[model samples]
Target: MANFSTNEFKAGLKIMLDGEPCNILENEYVKPGKGQAFNRVKIRKLISGKVLEKTFKSGDTFEGADVLDTTLAYLYNDGEFWHFMNNETFEQIAADAKAVGENVKWLVENDDCTITLWNGNPISVTPPNFVELEITETDPGLKGDTAGTGGKPATLTTGAVVRVPLFVQIGEVIKVDTRTGDYVSRVQK
Candidate 1:
């Protein structure tokens, strides 16, 4: 168990607090003209996804959390839990909806995903920033109409619906940004 001082607090730092692992989302130092300095930290709980703010003295220390992220191949979803497999060891890991969060819409079979493990258990799952998905359903595109100033809604193969350019067709594969659920570009070939 390593200790982290207030000066070491930064975004993406994981530390143990109140017997749970929490990720530091934001850390800001505040010094008053008359009083002592403190660090304001915004942290999100690992397991439950709850977020809170805590203040620590300038010299306060916190234990480092045993958090690690590993790349895993996504297998499939069982309606209740999403399953992922480690390619090297053939070990499978299951994560519930909470852990998957909005990333579930970006998962396709065989896609590589980053799984955050805390104390040997998966605490979060992050899909690739960009995903290529084939459009399963969408309105037909008009002839000689290639501009996408006015896009149409499209349902992807993964059951996630997103707006695509008017030139996009149901059979065409397009790249989508998972973070914002926006269409990036059409996949060539």
Candidate 2:
């Protein structure tokens, strides 16, 4: 564990409070003209998903959790558990669905992802920021809809639906931004 002053607080930083794990959701450095400076932070409990607000003096120090990240390849799911293999050692680790959560939609077999480990256990899984997938189904472009202002809903191979320009047709590959689940552009291939 490392000590960090309140001034070092930032979003996504894991810290230990009262012997429990919490993640910083938001942090603001607040000071009223002549008053003492402090950090107002909104934190969420990692295990319980509960959120709470706390304030700390600028000079106060808190114990930062020792979180580590490692690149891992996502393997096939085993019904209840999502399995991943460490890129370096090829060791497999299984984590509950909740740990992977919505990221499961962006995961493709053998895809590489960053897995955050807390105390050697999988805490969170982050998928690639962008992915290329083929459009499985969508309405054919309408006649004389040359302006291309309107878009049609298309389903990807992974079963996630996204709106793509009318020109997009079935079996066409397109790039998607997983962060927002939006279409980036059509893939040439």
Candidate 3:
């Protein structure tokens, strides 16, 4: 319903393009010595997760998209859908496997997650930046290897595998960076 001029284009801005909601990933302006200037925008489609680039004249505009981000506590997956609830309102929503994507591996019961909604429906789910999950399987820890000089692959409780220090062992809880899937440190207790 709202219009956004090219001047307002910036990373993270959401607007409608070709009848679909798209989030602006990058916006670059170009001006020539002899002609008019234009803007190049890189955007990602909300529903399909596709990225594309478009160019617009300096004064062009686009319709604003109805996008919102909210924090919700994850409930559980019913094989077909993953559920989440708003702690304050107790409102619940379900996201299909497409919406969950690869983030399903980082979800843990009762954990808070960032959910992106478009037109009152979820389009994407983001897990916490860092999570502490127990190592369900891995090779036995090497004796006197507390320094973590060498690393080994560890399977987390959520089924995601990551390389951890040699000192890490199965059944130990460790903090991991969800964004990079890197081992951060061991969780005390």
Candidate 4:
């Protein structure tokens, strides 16, 4: 494993801390009036999704973690694990509910997702920025509301609910921003 000195610490850098893999979220250099310089870092554990803050003396080193991000196509969820496959390699990997977390709501079969792997195993999953899904359920739109003056809650095909324009209706496909769970617009198709 490679060692990362405190000076080289930066956001998104993966390192081993207390035998666990963690990604640096923030690194702040601090120097007291009379003491040596130090680095204050905020990191998130790869496996448990926990955030922690720690301070290290200048020039301190940490072992690098074996972490990689790969894009895979979602296959299916078998109740316990969500499966994904590498389109080019045809290799498949299973991630447990903990790894998928809330992103599972945005996942649809055949969709490409970025999976973060630690030591060759999935630690986290990231859904795409936008997705188009059919509205499975929603109240009927009011008459003459085609101008989209207001919004109403609508259930999507993937089971995630978001506020859509009044003109949106059930069975209509709408574009959604996954990161904010906001309705972008009604899909023409």
Q: Model 3 residue 171 lDDT? A: 86
Instruction: Provide C-alpha RMSD values for all models, in order.
Output: 2.0, 3.1, 1.5, 1.7
Q: What order do you get sorting by TM-score, best first?
A: 3, 4, 1, 2
Using TM-score as the measure, the top candidate is 3
Point out the worst 10-residue segment of candidate 2 by lDDT. Answer: 141-150
Ranking by lDDT: 3, 4, 1, 2
Measured against the true structure, the TM-scores of the candidates, in listed sequence, are 0.88, 0.80, 0.93, 0.92
lDDT of 4 by residue, 73-180 (tens): 999999899999999999999999989998888998899999999889998999989988999999998856864466889998879999988877889999889999
Evaluation by lDDT, superior candidate among 2 and 3: 3
Over 4 Å off, model 4: 146-150
**Candidate 4 whole-model C-alpha lDDT, 0 to 1:** 0.91
Model 3 C-alpha lDDT per residue in residues 73-109, reported as the tens digit of each score: 9999999999999999999999998889999999999
Q: What does the lDDT read for residue 159 in candidate 3?
A: 97
lDDT of all predictions: 0.90, 0.84, 0.92, 0.91
Q: Candidate 4 has which clashing residue pairs, if any?
A: none
